[model samples]
Target: MGRSTLRFRRPAVTTRRLIRGLLAFAILAALGWNSVLLAAGNSMQGAKKEEGGFEGEAPTAILIEATSGAVLFEKNADELRAPSSMMKLMTAEVVFHAIKQGDIKLTDEYHVSENAWRRGGAPSGTSTMFAAIHSKVPVDDLLHGAIIQSGNDACIVLAEAMAGNERAFAEMMTKRAREIGLTRSTFANSNGLPDPGNKMTVRELAMLARHIIQTYPEFYKLFGEKEFTWNKIRQPNRNPLLNSLEGADGLKTGYTKEGGYGMVGSAVQNGVRLIVAVNGLEDPEDRANEAKKMLEWGFRNFEVRTVFAENETIGYAKVFGGNTGSVALASHEPVKVMVQKNGNDKLIARVVYNGPVRAPFEAGQKVGVVKVWRGANVAVETPVYAMDSVDRGSTLRRAFDGVTELAIALFRAGVAKL
Candidate 1:
């Protein structure tokens, strides 16, 4: 496989001329397998402050733009740690998905088992919605209890109601998580109680939060509710951001001796939404403050910039055994990135695909992805598709392409030996 990288310094303003220049640069740069670095200019002087300097006390954290899914800043974002009750987000997602699929209804009632009552109810000495044993509860109330009250009993009841047991429900949670693009998250139980099997990364947590917000707009409102009342017991929402930050709407908070303190929070400012996930803090107050600070920092510093307009050719992908040597690549949606407004950030954009691809593909077929990096983190990545279809080449052309691939493979094998 081969890779092509185009490195350039991001300018203060992005214009049509800059994009055209980058396209011409990509055409020439794609001819070589190695990376090409183009210096547009040196860093601007007299900048008031450097970019990406905001630091938080959380050991694992990530902040991202909600609409574009652009990473603004991250620290140990991929390191898997106990997610605590933040994993309840996954629990809520599972229930939400089932409801969306029409497999269940909000009015459906579940019988609370003795296990749920004894382990997660008032006797458990943990966050509980004070559910009564042997009593039937509606799914609507359970959702409110789980999201707003952080009620372990509510999650357990929902899990049992859906999958017959918490273990099976957790398997469903992990499977559903994968289906929604959360790759590294796993669940042991519904309420994110202490368990060796529950693990998640801050980055994936942020991604999950974004997915929930986008996928279930109606159900997501439950996250922002300040308080929930069930069975005559009313409890306030655990997520402090809802009360502390302006424009803060919904999300969840978690804590345990093992996972420390963690929360997934989202807030909107001036019509721009930002999501933040922080874990492994020493104090609950620190967790709330750190999440709030990160969201504020992201909104204050980053601005979205379009990299490529919709249907505009992003680059090219080499084709094997095709009438044409390469196919033009473009994204269906406009590719956008969030960057520090005043920083002189050097951006590296690359088109990555396993190629030369075997041909006979249709137009709009996915060919590769365009990844843009700001500083050390990937600011944004989007799928690039073929702009036009390519037919199979003549027999002579196929033979030549086969020979070329063989020679290239041998050269790579030799390089590996070195």
Candidate 2:
């Protein structure tokens, strides 16, 4: 199932200023910042929201933690639909990954073919880089053709140039998509030109964008360049949100009669990167504005505040059958909350698990659940794992229980030998 966004729109200055003032007073008073922030406000402007599924109703929309692949929001994230030019992200990503792996070169040139030049309007049609047959253009130009201009001909040329043929390269693409954990995508062509079996979900596209950006930082500049020129032809980027959305960087745009307007866009604001993908849009500009609105709403509303550090003792867990009476409970990672900038303290944290816990636990094994709450509802529930191993009681001697353990161990050892 997909999930709804904890999304809301509000002017940010008021909450920010309030948080700032509270921080200053806390510093001067030498008191806790979290305590002060919690004590001060009672506003919903910064309150936690209810999360719900977005997968069933919409075709596919997903907002993800660009770096972590942690799904922040989603709508039918697994459904396959026309990827539009968003397919070019994969095309570009494949080429770049190849370059990074030394499979091709920056200056390598390819001869354009007639089939590439022949792709024109719908029924397996769309834009062109105006690339002509027999023209020996560099891989760099073909890159622009496939990406900036959304050129089908350029895509085919690059595919053929990198591999012996486009079909081979597309197979490589699907293989790579699976390797990158993209379960909801399949590629039938190098270009995003609508094909009978070609489709991707919004989650897959965003995942591709995040991976390409993070995994190939050295090559990301290509997507940000506003325009490119080759063989006396000029091509501008297709993503309209590049300049229209403040802090917007690079992403791809797509449109086929069936896919409508689609975009995979990201922006960096106050050091946080937010990526949003929307398909089934009615028009190009409509998708662009929706992207901007969603991004602005996200950036404006949230700011992270730490409540506890990893290994910081949250409380003590009472062990049921262990040498120690209690184990120090803590978060495995920093416990932080995304609260409205200046909003009041509606956030609460509670740790729950099976009482204390039985022994035989290992370090980092989850033993309890941490539910972050806002007022009456839970905001997020994450597991709190054992910070260190809690060995099982050694005094007990069992025949059947020990045999079960021995069998499991022997089975694993045999599998390892095989």
- Candidate 2 per-residue lDDT, tens place, 1-418, comes to 1222222223354565565556445433431122122312223443334332223223567765454344555677677899977888888888888888898897998887766666631223467777767778788777777777777888888887777787888888998888888876888888877786678988788888999889988777777778877657787887777878777778888888888888898888777777888888887777887777666766775555566667776655655455554566677777665555546436666677665366767777767766666555444555676666776654552343344345545545644654
Residue-level lDDT of model 1, residues 1-418, one tens digit each, is 1222222323423454465456545544544333222212312234444545687789999999998788887899999999999999999999999999999999999999999998899889999999999999999999999999999999999999899999999999999999999888889999989999999999999999999999999999999999988878878998898878999998989999999999999999988899999999999999998999899888887777776789977678888899988888888998777767776566666788878878888999998888877667667778989999999999988898888777566545644654
Error of 1 at 179 (Å): 3.4
Q: All candidates' lDDT scores?
A: 0.85, 0.69
For each candidate, what TM-score against the reference? 0.86, 0.67
Clashes of each: 0, 6
The model with the greatest TM-score is 1
Cα lDDT for residue 143, candidate 1: 92
Give candidate 2's whole-model lDDT.
Answer: 0.69
